[model samples]
Target: MLAHLRSNPSLLKLDLYCKGIQLDDSCLVTDDGGRPILRTRAGLGSGLEAILPGGLWTNVPVTEPFAQHSPYTLHRFTSGTYWIHWQGEPVTEVALSPRPAWYDATLPNGKEMTHIGTLQGTYLGIYQAKVCEYWTAKPEKTNCKFCSVGLNLGVDDADEKSVEEVMTVVRRAREESGITYVDFNTGHYDGDTYLDILEPYILRIKEELGLLVGVQTPPHRDLKRYDGLREMGVNRVSFCFEIFDPKLFREICPGKHEEYGLDYYLEAIRYCAGLASKGPRHEPWVTNGEIIAGLEPPESSIAAIDWITSVGAVPTVCVFRPLVHTDLEDWAPPKTEEMVPVFRRLYEACMERGLPIGCAPNVHVSLVMLPEECAGLSKKRYPWQRLKLEAKKRMFKYAFERRLQTLERRVA
Candidate 1:
């Protein structure tokens, strides 16, 4: 697939979500022997020496890796040509994201600046506050099995950054990095108290930073809280129902489903969208229904996407990649081929309905970047077929396992 994409040169934006560090590993600079000499969590060029026109490495001061905890930078290569090494296999000749100036900067507080609050490109990824009350409740506990929130928490002394600090970082990021849009996500908080804690920070960023900001939260205790969100300068809102299947929701995200219940989540999404008043500018309060592809059935997954759209929210489907040191580390990610169609179908549906893709910036490829040959009919069909089959296969396997469990219990 990488070779095919490379030969085409027209495939512009690729949403390589859930591929993990291997997707991130795309940023490493390799020696002549193909061994990585340096690894960066930022954009590709950060760790690469100034390679001459002939591709010869030179002695240069390579900036430290950009660390916003996103995989968008991997999409920007010179002229959008790069390679992705997945599970040790090289998916070569892919396009990389444009390196932002703020990829390597230091803040007023002596903190390394790499757009700590938001990332650049077609996808806008944000961590509203580094700290979550869930982590506070169990200091030893990690974030949800799918998150890397603890990566920053484990290293930094401060868990949550002040609104002043966030505003400063965002201002610097926009002025320096050319970041246009921002998405904000938080860890779980205790009760309904966290909304107040987040309001000031959200408002300051919207007013002070002045970028299109998206906020992700559980259903707000008071729907009225959304009024504050809009006044604070928020353009979109995402209430992530991570897994739409009821049983999977309980098993995978017990804390969220148990705390809020599925009906409340649906109601919140509807209410938030209504409050935001969706349209081209404020057309729909961008609502995101997050589906972890490999964990549930394809029909169920597709049904969830339909549900989100039915409620006038966009379905933001993500491949399920387990994070290291999390509860589900032993789990494996869904096949990349399997994810393509789900993405394409959901994207097409949203496009048809005029719903904006709000979860990750990359998902809304047309917003920030465009792939070269996306207009070609064949290019469009390939992703659709591949993703649909993979989604179906995984869903079947899950059902099979459940049936086997039922039989075993009867035998016992």
Candidate 2:
């Protein structure tokens, strides 16, 4: 049931992304207790991710999936009553990722804390210095045709956020929403400008809040810079080599291909894991290779899963979302049925390797099911493995509940 919810986000949501928490209309979908849920479009375009109860992560459609019809809709009972129904039956109780208590927090600079970083899934996302050189560069030669990262410039958040503004939100989110990580995304600005600009923010986040940091950027010309990032306590690194097929990768991500090539991304992550393994600090997974599952043939995704896991990196597979107003707006995404087998293969590959699967629930985003959750479908698990998995699941639940409990000041 959880997997279905994660797979079929368009089945329930009326909108593709969350309308900002500042708007009461964002409450079109909310919990039974009458708290606003997050499933409306955000930013300049309609791409967004949402986390469901029990840590299930899903990519929501920006528009209606079925052209003004779907089996699922929110059924309101009494004034404070709500339930998610599919095909006229209440399948299960559902809730949205709530507005974090610090959404309205004000920074010392007078800018609202949320205006600096938007809450995405469980982590806060800061698209600091939103300019991407590729978008401005020769259009035909650069710019990933599928990406809208640069399209968001000046639409909502600032082009550049100061360290202090980001710090205010991080601290408040930790206290209020219990966010454990900050995922910083950037486009190459002035030849390695992305990391150079992001480094200070990373350093402050580590020294001030002791938060885990994840970076998504094109690989630096010098792969050794990854060691520098690890030394500064970056928890994870991801490269969006969106497709496994080389020709398609080069075509879709012309900037990444022409600038650094796929080898740069693969080697950088392999090196990150190796450096962390030999270093004093170690976490479950140090590197992630992000692949859009439906962008290429399912076979390409499965092959990518095999290769990425083989090289000490986990594959963060996203279902392809054809956003409105992007170059690929008219493109259609694969059906949910097509993705089940692809994700199932992904789950098996990770389990076969015994890679540490899920991040701590507090920090893990639900854009897709973590390897640990997908491992549930494995019928051939060893008895001991099942016991260990159960124990870990309990641990995550208990840890997450502890954070939620803090919200109930009445209990304490």
Candidate 3:
């Protein structure tokens, strides 16, 4: 098992999520040109971003209490090199996720570029709206127990972002970072206004930049709003129903349980998954039913993955990180052994269903292991299916890049 982990970068990433790394005295993150640790929206990632062997980008936890006891430690040498040492033995050399120049640049309105959005792996991630209504509800708050969205707003992310400001940052990310995808995430609102708040930004990104755009927000009260999103060129829609066990779901995500029941989330996922064949054929569409693994039993998480894939929607399984100051702050993260089966199912379920996993270009996520990235965890192999996916990847990349170039020339 140890040998396999050392050999496979994706497994290393999964283990790092469960057992975070400790920083050595020789380590100097930003001083050595590393990206600063900022608690962005949702606050799931608050760590140093580094690329492991085999080009796997990851956010390694350093500030959390569990990380302080980890056997893994990151070391920076006097010659300006970084290596990960496990039990005082070197495991693999790592590279810092590059700090884009625009991270230091400011907008015309004097807002910092990073305040609008930040890179998650190679793609741009913007927390599109204000704090979730659950966090701001009067008398008492009912936000997700494991989330830090309320705690992060107005700190790392700006309280509000204009569509024009977002477009400027999106253009810069594409031009400089070579990002082909942009993801916008939002929390609950009073009037199901999250979709209304996001459509303008999505339209501009599609019309002007011609990049792949995704929306991760609460399921709207009106399911038909998704049809309009598809026609508007939204390539992906993700609903984060963070726990699968019905009873636990209510306890963990009180606001979600109260506002839109778990059944509604599943229904929306099914509804949106069916929209794949109805939209513009040039635009690839995917529906993700996201869940946090550590918040529930391994069997429950696997069940969620199975149900999601059964419906032609992919499962995005996230390792529950007990971020500081959140309601679940004292909870322990799931063990890697317990999570291996969950992630293995994640890959197998998607492959068995012939879902389009890992087709996006330059989209390597740092917060969670993508389904395709979990291929290493499973012993099962699907050679024919793998071949079909490769062909699709090449075709999609070519078409998408050609569209971007044509748009750029037209604007020029």
**Top of the candidates by TM-score:** 3
lDDT of 2 by residue, 1-412 (tens): 4445544443222122221112122235533232232322122223324444455544444352422243444444555444555555564445455666576567776776655776776788777776778888864537777676656666556766878777777778878878877888777765687788889999887666656688988788788887778777787788878888999998888888888888877887677657647543432237888888667998888899898888878888776665555676566666655666667777788777666566355666545556655544445565565566567656755754554455345335
For residues 1-412, could you state the per-residue lDDT of candidate 3 as single tens digits? 5576679887899999998999999988887778888885766788889998877888988788989998899999888999998888888889999888999999998999999999998999999878999998878798999889888887788888998999999989988999999999999999999999999999989999999999999999899999999999899999999998999999999999999999999999999999999979899999999999999999999999999999999998889888999988898989999999999999999999999999998899888899988888888889999999999999999999899889989999
Q: Candidate 3: where is the Cα deviation over 4 Å? A: none
Which candidate leads the pack in lDDT?
3
Query: Candidate 1, residues 354-386: lDDT per residue as tens digits?
Result: 453332221233111121112221333445544
Against the true structure, candidate 1 reaches a TM-score of 0.66
Candidate 2 error regions (>4 Å): 1-27, 30-53, 62-69, 79-81, 139-141, 282-285, 359-361, 382-412
- Pitting candidate 2 against candidate 3, the one with the higher TM-score is 3
Q: Assess the local accuracy of residue 146 in candidate 2 as a C-alpha lDDT between 0 and 100.
A: 69
Compute each candidate's TM-score over C-alphas: 0.66, 0.81, 0.98
lDDT of 3 at 150: 86
Model 1 regions more than 4 Å off: 1-92, 98-101, 114-126, 136-143, 156-158, 278-284, 357-412
Output the lDDT of residue 261, model 1: 75
Q: What is the lDDT of candidate 2?
A: 0.63
TM-score of 3: 0.98
